[model samples]
Target: MERHCVFVTIFVLILHLVQAQNQTGFISVDCGLSPPESPYNAPQTGLTYTSDTGLINTGKTGRIAKDFEPFVDKPALTMRYFPDGIRNCYNLNVTRDTNYLIKATFVYGNYDGLNVDPNFDLYLGPNLWTTICLVKTGISIPFINVLELRPLKKNVYATQSGSLKYLFRMYVSNSSRRIRSVKMGQNHGSTQLNSTHEP
Candidate 1:
């Protein structure tokens, strides 16, 4: 075979192998959001959350008609199906030796000019969320990502078998007017499972 053709074939095979190992899924959940006493930036359709019940008739229309009106908005969906499950949904299955970037996405909008604990806490399988500080004076943090959730960061954990399993949960412990959500994502790695070195 020509040198170029041989190289091209080898590259394609490796690409497929890598892609096969990395899979992604989306897990979603639905809860509720409290309307701010004085909503200035609330979407025209008003913002609300759902409880993920199969029944979609959560009076969403009535709220939209009254608050959203012609604007035709309601609330930001906080939860959703991470597909097979929430954990490992965003990124593909994890194996030892390969590095990955797991991102957590959040959406929130609450400003009382004071410190406010989360309206709820998200449970990612056995992984515990440490905490995040939004004490930027007048800055109202309504959203966050993995990078934003920096306080309880975990980058490296070791395992002999080279695999991990996880799930996700965004439960509201206290009723707050603020709304928010969580998501996950994954990236390519330099090595494969059981390999001595990352690719």
Candidate 2:
């Protein structure tokens, strides 16, 4: 009987991903903003920056330091810039056996002044999420990370595996490297960052 209707359609899609994994999945994206607005007096509450509308692949939007006070009040997300290619994505609408609290932020206000400080390679769909080395000490050096997602299916492809971590964070820096302040806890269980180097 067609293998019992393919095992009853994979058990009704894993029982609709366990009833949509207990209803509570908030996704905030402010990657490379430009004409994409939603964050100015939001301080931070289910953050939103849907420029290019849930981008999945497309690039070329750079801006750096223009009265930039570390993104003032989150100036629509660090003034704006998404300079990386070949695998740039932002298609978040997850819920397939869910468990998420994914927060991704990046700011490199050197913007191409060639002060250069880049290292990018973060993905969740094709799974290899984490490799952002932006420690250029001229100012904008905020590369926040706090991802805890355990989705086994239903679209997971965030690929940026090369660019040599932006020339290895603009040829490495060591002024005693110190700027680590990212505290996000409430554990969703399933977070791993075996230190691929970050400061």
Candidate 3:
């Protein structure tokens, strides 16, 4: 009986070690969330996300309109908006020369009830990463919903200088039967090349 108990403890320890290794180099942030509602696991992705309160000093917290709440994931329901300041940035601690995949999600669900899209710029360490023009109508505001970072393998996607910006990703089957595309910044705009696929 004692030997059996020892074996069970060893199995449990191995399981805990595997789980910790899987979550080692990952950071997920849900902007605009406070203490009580901060740390929660996303229902869709099954990933734990923490509040971004300590990472950024600027920006005001706001929730999306009631009508659009059901259309987005839990992380995208609230946002951090920057109305003032020429440049607002989030501070993250990352390894010096490690490659990381950074993803920022933006969902303009009429959070301000203005029914107008926002336009702004995104920068990465003093470099202009991209111009975030939600619509062509010319609006002015900056907001973010979710931000995630994952460490990548050293030999994968090696660049000569600067960093890589994520735009979009697609998966194609071997038979070219179906294609699935996921565009960053727009979480509700995924497209799949199947009749029954829903966005």
Candidate 4:
């Protein structure tokens, strides 16, 4: 009995260690930033936010954030912008057969001082993720976070409406696969299926 208990404890420890490693697979992007710029100061979030200037091959610089006090606190995250485009994308290498919580945050600081608010769309590769409306301060816009049982191969993209400029952030949260699909978009629909992994 004692030997069995020891074996069970060892198995539990190994399972916990595997879970810890899986939880570390995450990516955060500070859109519209160039190299040598500091990362967003949010270590408490356990995610590293990096510049997206050279990371992707689209988007034009429209504004900077040093002038806005709301952005000054998270300079790396807010100090850049991506103007309207068909599809601005970033390709990332993630673990195969894993699930992820993909989140994109937008804040229009009116950096251009134009006082104009705009709307745009977000995408996950060929999939039409959702649309985002940028509003001024004191007003909150509903954001979307997609839970994807990401195929071993996939890409993420962002689209703009060409009406106005804005700044945003992208966060890819990793989690163990539980459900098949969780959809959040204009259609308001969902489907589920069982996933099987072979040894």
Answer with 1 or 4, whichever has the higher lDDT: 4
Q: TM-score of every model? A: 0.24, 0.26, 0.67, 0.46
Q: Clash pairs of candidate 4?
A: none
- Candidate 2 per-residue lDDT, tens place, 97-136, comes to 4434344444455656665445433443322332222222
Off by over 4 Å in 4: 1-23, 38-46, 62-67, 71-80, 127-199
lDDT of 4 by residue, 136-180 (tens): 222222111111122221232223531112233332323242333
Give the lDDT of residue 116 in candidate 1.
Answer: 43
Candidate 1, 1-199: lDDT as tens digits: 6999999999988866754542232122122333332222224322222232332212221111132233322334222211122122112223334433333434332322233443322323221222111111122222222121111114555456333323343443244433343433221312111101111
Instruction: In angstroms, give how far residue 180 of model 3 lies from its true place.
Output: 23
Can you write out model 3's per-residue Cα lDDT over 1-199, one digit (the tens) per residue? 9999999999988866755456567788898988688788787666788998888888789999998888789999988888767667787767767777877787878888886545555544432322122121124678889888888889988888645655453433223334333333422231111111122
Please identify which of the two predictions, 1 or 2, would achieve the higher lDDT against the true structure: 2
Clash tally for model 1: 25
Q: Tell me the spans in candidate 3 whose CA falls farther than 4 Å from its real position.
A: 1-21, 127-139, 169-199
User: For candidate 4, which ten residues in a row score worst on lDDT?
Assistant: 190-199
Q: Which portions of model 1 miss their true places by more than 4 Å? A: 22-101, 105-127, 130-137, 144-156, 159-199
- Reference-based lDDT, residue 167, model 2: 15
Error of 2 at 41 (Å): 23
Best by TM-score: 3
lDDT of each: 0.29, 0.40, 0.67, 0.40
lDDT of 3 at 194: 13
Candidate 2 vs candidate 3, lDDT winner:
3
Q: What's model 3's TM-score? A: 0.67
